[model samples]
Target: MSEAISYIWLGVLAVFEAPALFSLAGIGIPAPLVMLLCGLLTGIAVGATPGLAGPMAMAVSLPILISVFGVSADALLPVFAFLIGIMKGATVGGAVPAILFNTPGTPDAFMTTLDGHPMTLRGTPERALKIAHFSSVSGDTVSDIVLFVCAPFLAVMVESVLDLPEKTALIILSLSFIAAVMGASVAKGLISVSLGMVSAYVATGQGFHPRLTMGVEALSDGFPLIAAVLGVLILGEVFKSIFDMWRGIRRKRAEDHNADLAPDGLRPGDIRRILPHIGRSSLIGCMVGALPGVGSTLAATLGHSLGKRRHETRKGPTDKSFGEGIPEGIAATEAANSAVSGANLIPVLSLGIPGNAAAVFLILAADSIGGFNPGPSVFNFAAPEINPELVVAFGIFTLMALGNLLNWTIGGIFMRSMGVMARVPNRILLPVVLLVTLTAIYVQETSLAALWVAIGFGVLGFFFRVLEISVLPFVIAFILAGSLENTARQAFSASGGDPFFLFRSPVACGMLAAAVILVVLLARKK
Candidate 1:
């Protein structure tokens, strides 16, 4: 405890001191870059081990993180707050490649290709990248503030006397929200979610002890979250691309259109144009992020769609030209996606459940190393041992803030110069990514079986992509499956199997009421 407190104090001093160092005139270095490098170095060190992942890094570093400078939960709060900023910044930083070279650094940046790529075709790739970075940063910062203010008040209400049944009901409500908010059709969303639930059950050893292992000893340990995510989202995308290539969907052009690039910098007017949509996109992003299964892709798509819809409805006849390489599309998508980074952390920090795939990996890593669980108890019990939870949180926030500032300050310049990155042959990139993933997984358990499972899931992920199903639901379901089951068991035991115990608590009853209201509203809309 003493050690944790000391680290907290140290972190606080750094927080105040960092800005002063960053503000030194003509230093030409941005604060966020420093934070990103710190996070990256930390991530590489912790993530470098075979079995280690992000959460594990946090857990393992907990003792040192706490002891180094008298860190404690309260003291670390600013650090975590700073991470919110870092995540937001990083999300935007990804857009640089997406616009300049049609390569999306992050999955969520895929939508930026629609108009951003076109802007590149029209010789404004740098401008498009700049707009994306600035708009994304603006949206993320604004959304973080909103979440910081609202999460506590929301937690207060949620913490009030809730029993097991009500909590289950609330989970149901969250699922329903996902169904309503996801994809083009309710039917498709339902199907995607159902598949995810099934996958979660299979991976978690349900029904029988050591379930679905097929006599493989390694399978008894269950699936690795990171491997699963890589398989489903990243590897899956890769497979889909391969399939597309097999079917002759590959682009044949080789020449760089803007070979002699003269990129434009973002003007003050550009920032002003995107400011109005930032709040709306950020709110949407946060709400989606807080809900499990809904990721940044959906958030960006929904934000853009809504913005387009609103514009079309307002313009009527003039709306025909609405979505053609417009800045609004960039603003809406970036804001929505960036906002998700912070909102997603809410459930991870407060509930111990991961809202998306990356978070799920982080959670598993944390459990393996920190000896901490990712739920409400973490804040109370683990805060002593890892008292620097707040510091870590603040660290994340600082990382995000610095990340964004760096992206805004140098993203355009770097993107313009780094256009060659996009031209790299996919043949090389794909294999390298696969090799890294395999090496990472092998280091964790040294099990060949795990590698096979990852490959299998990679194939499965590809199929899902082809079917146009959302992979986020599967990730969310996987993270929550155990919690839902455990909570149900406890509720049943407490109620002596009466089932009424769920409704007995005021908090539970209120949750039930809210669920009912949401269901009614969804039904009415349908």
Candidate 2:
């Protein structure tokens, strides 16, 4: 109880102190720099092991999270919040490399290449990256502020009157939103979600887990989140590319002889050009990020589409047209993608529901060590044990600010240096990545089985990428399936299996209505 109270106080302090910290930095040291250092240390340590990714870090830290902070629910809030904030900032900071060197430092920054590459071609790569970084940071910061302000109110309403049935309905509603907003086709997205649910059920129930096992018995506990992510996002991609090369589907390009091809820094005019679309893109990103399944790529696409639509609808000849190499497209995409970083945390932090694969891993990590559960009850139940809010706020603020600082100070240098990494033979890098993944998984559970599971997922992930199916849905659904099932079962048991009992509460009814509406709208779109 004392620990929980201390956590809550810490959360309050972090919340109030974030803005002050921002102000103090007023062009002194960049926030992104600090975030980069922290994240770099964290990532290197986590990434060095094959099976330990961001989620695993969180999981491994759970013992410390619970013991050091105490097991109260609220105590975990601040830590989770801080993680979210850091993720938000880091997601944006990653684009610096993606824009400058065509090497996406993070998975979420992939889409930045579309416009970012073009700017690099125009000899303004630094300017483009800077703009992207600024827009992303701006969007994320704004969205976090929004989440901080709104989540409590939403939680209040959810906690005060929501019964079991109402809660179940809300979960369904959230799921529907996820399916509808994600992927090009709602059917495909829903199918992906269904696949994830089935996989989770099979893994948990049948005991033949989807991504666990390395053909060894020791890893039977199941695959660690870290291993799965590294395989899917990093190692898998590298292997796939190598395979393609082997098949002659891809060939090495001749080294660029022209030194002039290198990117020049951004111009002052570039910043001014992107300013107009900042607000719109940020809003789009925040909304999309708050929903599950819809990730940074979609957020970027949506922001671009909205910007184009707005630009087209304007009557007179405007100085800024969106499509023809205009900075607004870059701005909108950057802001939207960045905004997702923070907003994605809303569900993960407030409820145990993970909106994306990364959050799903985080949830797994939290669950592994008997820490806080994800849900509305987390705030109330854990409040006395751990202050999740404070941890979340502090971590986020630190990471976001640090990430941005890193972007401003060394982002360009990093991008320039990344060319060396890209030049490194894939043969060496792939094996290294694989080795790291294997080692990480082995340490997590002392099991070789987990390593095999990661390999299996890597192959599956490669196939999914080739097939053009949305992997996000499957990942999100898999994470949420257990909670959804448990909650529904509880609600049903409480209501004596009477379906109508779920509709008795106004909140439940409203959520159901919304779900229906969402389905109808999606059907119409189809």
Candidate 3:
């Protein structure tokens, strides 16, 4: 117990006493805290804007931030702090446009629009914004507490039990599960996964003879990871949005909520009215976020549905019901989606699996920085001496707590300042975004070919969006491909070149069998 307490103390000290970003009047300011605020503010600003999101901001800033703050071991906390702050701030900021402009800043914020915009139309935008901010911070705090308690134990448990083959099978199961759940049909999701895996595996193999290089020497190193990830995600969306705008068929607006303005609206006491909804939805979001590949959209949907059901069951229906400018609706949706930001790290920190796009950026930051290896090893407590990773992990917890503090105090100010961002049209916004993204990729990799590969992946992403396929599976598969391949190879060699090495252990066999069963069941369900 003393050892544990000491380690936690050391972690906190590391964050405060580490290298500073800059000095003011001979006093060095901690880099992590500064970057956290900067990222959070940036996230809020972007999240309030239509056609921008936390993931996009994180993706764009990553390369640039790496350049500014060299990839030293000390830089890890600050970079991670910034990314996490973005995740938190964006989750809350997305509610701003949904309420004020009747625009969902992100898909999960679509649910917020149901009640949020209605409240705005009725001349109580402040109340709606307050409800969103309060509920979001509340949910985020709960989730952070849960993550702090759960991630270490979970990572340690996974480290103790899983070997190479078992881990390999687990990855297959995870990919299959993600594919099954993410899209309209299992087949389409599997196709997306296949495409991602193929892209990942191309030009990757032993030494001089890389597989699927197609006779191009540039292909020998494969596409740049940053370009491939951001291109498919950000640039692809840019293209899709531009095309949609050109066709004069932009995203359809929600149905009109101008009718039936209820005089009796969100009073200060209404916080009590929405408390139950917030509590339940926050739990829902945390659970879903912990599961790899499950995202904030589903959390918001489920929370809204449950809130509606509860309200109907309890008070019947009224002008101020779930979708009609009710505080409960805003509370439920905001809490649910905001909760996902903290809990999504469960998979990333514990299992080295990214649950969503924001989580993907977190993994990317770790990989690019090179000091941190996020997985079960991150929480290995048996190290006899001081474990730097453990200390850093604890520092991450401290930064998260500080972010929550910011959310409670000034986050509402940022959350409500969404109106200005809406003025920037997609025409100006998209091209600028694309230019910045490509420029950052080029600068970081110092390879012009990387830009072309990124553009190619962006086109592929555009197709994925047009076809209505969920991109989650594809991104997750791409990220996991290298780990999966390496683990499988190690397991194969350890098993004396056994073709069926994955089924050698009972746990591995069970997981592989589970993957098959899961796909079969999900297909039938689909």
Q: Taking the tens digit of each residue's C-alpha lDDT, what string does model 2 give over 204-303?
A: 4434454434454544444455555445554556567667767877332222222335456666676765676788888888888887667777788788
Better of 2 and 3 by TM-score: 3
lDDT of 2 at 302: 81
lDDT of each residue in 291-355, candidate 1, tens digit only: 86567887888888887776666655653333456566788888888788667767666655567
Q: What TM-score does each of the candidates earn? A: 0.73, 0.73, 0.96
Clashes of each: 48, 63, 0
TM-score of 3: 0.96
Kindly give the stretch of ten consecutive residues in candidate 2 with the minimal lDDT sum. Answer: 251-260
List the candidate numbers ranked by TM-score, top first: 3, 2, 1
- Top-TM-score candidate index: 3
Order of candidates by lDDT, top first? 3, 2, 1
lDDT of 1 at 169: 63
| RMSD of each candidate relative to the true structure | 7.3, 7.0, 2.0
User: What are the Cα lDDT values of the candidates?
Assistant: 0.58, 0.59, 0.87
Residue 17 in model 2: shift from native, Å?
13
Give a tens-digit lDDT track for model 3, residues 47-160: 888888888889878887888788988878889888988888888888888888887868889899999888887778888999999999999999999899899889988899
